[model samples]
Target chain A: MYYIDDFLALLFGISLLIAFWKVRTPLFFIASGACLTIIYSITLFFISETKPVQDIIFYSMACLGCISGLLFIRVMLIRSISLHALKLSNTMTKNKKECSIEDQLTEQMTSEIGFRLDDLQQKGFATLTTDGSGQLTLTPKGRVIAQLVSRLYRAIER
Target chain B: MDTLFIVALTTCILLAPIAAEIVLKGRRLQSNVKRVAPLYIVIALCCITIGAYTHYPHPIVIVMYWCGYFLTWFGIRSHLESSILLKMLTTLQTSNLSRDELMSSYLQSYSTQSRIAELKNSGLLESKKGIISITPSGEKLLSIIDLLD
Candidate 1:
């Protein structure tokens, strides 16, 4: 019975990792991470007859594993080095003519800027304001996030 | 009781990376990952080996230590790997930067030619008849990454 419970815990833990790896956005990650953790913990609690300390440690390990998995996915997705390189390659496929590095570099920069602008608007961090002129302005939430990130940057450097 | 010791040890081991990040500010995020991530892996391996020999082979504790190391490393690496635009916003929190200036500065940081040369050297890219294409492995990797995005 005990071995079976351990097996179930391991199974649930692995499933949570798979879900995390499949997550592409931060919002999806948060929702799925919370749901999966709760389900895994509740299942483990009912099946395992371990001591409180053991149960806590098991739960903690599972949570940490999920977080680590999600973070690994996040880093891979956000890394622009390879993405830019791939984009350049794809661009070359469309243009049979020899392309210069500067052209690819410009395209990459434009793509990055567009991506960030889209993220800001989607997340409500920035807004488009028009009074016969289009301008990007940070929302209150955006300002707060910017400030928090700045503080975090300073702390990391320190 | 042994779990307590293992937890404490994991906490102490985790601090090593934080110290390394602070001490190695001169290194970029990519270089730091290469240097510090392996350090954590080595420490975790040492703990696992020692636990096996000490007759207190708690596999749960080993798992805990591995998770702890990963979390610590991930926290630092992800923060440092933030997009240049986000970093610009963060800097804008203190001082404003003109759009043209920001774009120029950010663009300067990227060297597409060098990056292409690197991919070619790694055999992920090849140019045939003046047309460049990704190798099979490169295509597979790009597709996987695209799915994630």
Candidate 2:
């Protein structure tokens, strides 16, 4: 039982360090959560005289749950920052009724959107390739992700 | 057996929102975490009370049980709040939205505007005569993000 307490404390302490490092990606959190679960489970199994499987499973499940919660919060904050960046990048003048006569969104929003596109490409979830008419199309990976999201949307009815 | 029962109950409590979503035919209640979280909390508390009366397990068991509940609460709240991005992704997946249209619509939403107002109120940015600018602290935050990237 004391070991379980120590395990929880250590899990949270490592999670805090990761948060401070600003590694706020969902993938990072998921990977860390899984990795830590396995590592701790093995450590506890070997270290305990009785090799309790139930304790190991319990700790692993708790770790995964807590890490997932932290990940969701972190990603939410990161997405908000993206919006804040777009807002902060706004450079509208007082006299101008619009940031640009042609652009509905401010220049900053466009640029941030472009950055997000580039980021998706860099992450290999997407790619930018111009067609014969200079139109862009999703890569195979992008198509797969898009299809998955669409299916999920239909399933959830959201 | 007591430990097993507590663990199973915690899992059920954690999964209640999903079950609620299914039972309600995917209709969310007011789209707020507060609306659904209390039901889970009440259920958890009832189980804990009954378990305590029956067994009076170690204090650590009680502490661990509540910690799990806290994690469940946080996870549920975060999931509900962060569904905005999922919604956006779903929209993008189903239909095309130009960058301008997307950002403009996002800004037009009352919640987004309120969030921006919050940033301004929190001193991360300031609005003067309709022009918004990031403060030094905001710059510091951006720099940290950049470093992380």
Candidate 3:
């Protein structure tokens, strides 16, 4: 019971990863994170001593756990798309060509990028234009999200 | 009052990286882990040292510290790097783009060569006599990534 909160938080994070293991989408991740957070919060209440300081600490742990889970899912999403590097490595490893890094570096990872664009379209950030031209355009929702991301990019640094 | 101080401390921890990115910009440290890890470590150490010195107050303070630490480290890394998808959408907002245009544009985040250099730096890959190959660590990393599928 000493650091039960930390243990519970770890549990919540694991539950989140399990929930996201199959779906691998933000909506699924969000739904699971929220549900797990609520369940854990309720469970914590049942077992907690309910001391003012103690309860505060316990709830804070749950909250942080939920946030960490959410952040982790986001990292996974980014890493998933960024696995173009992995794909490239796989390609090079499987290839017999003794190409220089300089030459191989210029290789086009078109399929992965195509998949990402298709994913963006599925997520409603962009859409294929209806003129049968297949031109991809951002939706209003996507514009807003893109704006927000751009702002964050400006606000922070690498 | 104690909670107030804890909240302030947590906020400071979360902001340290952004602050470092701002304050340390253009220096050699702005590169990557050299800058971010140091900030994260120093602040985490400060939190632990202070917690130990005070013999700890309420235990939830650990929650506050860890919450801030998690957000600061992973949050910043994702925000800085993972926003490639968002960056693509941002570019689209300016105008429609074919896949090639987007890939070949200023999308450094999606740039595989840079990513290779990064992984190479991280020891996931190695370059010899201008050739590139993956290390065993990189093979392990890809296998782990495969689990997500």
In order of DockQ, best first, we have 3, 1, 2
TM-scores of all candidate predictions against the true structure: 0.66, 0.53, 0.67
Off by over 4 Å in 2: A1-51, A81-111, A128-130, A155-158, B1-7, B10-14, B19-31, B46-149
- Model 2, A56-136: lDDT tens digits are 565566565666556655554565443444334443322333332223333444455557655654666433344444223
Which wins on DockQ, candidate 2 or candidate 3?
A: 3
Name the lDDT value of residue B95 in candidate 1.
39
lDDT of 2 at B91: 43
Estimate, for each residue in B35-111, the C-alpha lDDT of model 3 and write its tens digit. 56667666656665665555444344354445545554555555545555676887887888766677766345456
Q: Candidate 2 chain B: worst 10 consecutive residues by lDDT?
A: B56-65
Model 1 interface CAPRI class: acceptable
Best by DockQ: 3
Q: What are the lDDT scores of the predictions, listed in order?
A: 0.61, 0.52, 0.62
**For candidate 2, what is the lDDT?**
0.52
In the range B1-149, model 1's lDDT, one tens digit per residue, is 35655665566566766766765574445334556667667666766666556544554545554764566466555545446657656644543444554455555554456556656765667778755677776677678766767
Q: Which stretches of candidate 1 lie over 4 Å from their true place?
A: A1-6, A20-30, A71-81, A90-97, A115-158, B1-7, B19-25, B31-34, B47-61, B64-72, B108-149
**Candidate 2 or 1, higher lDDT:** 1
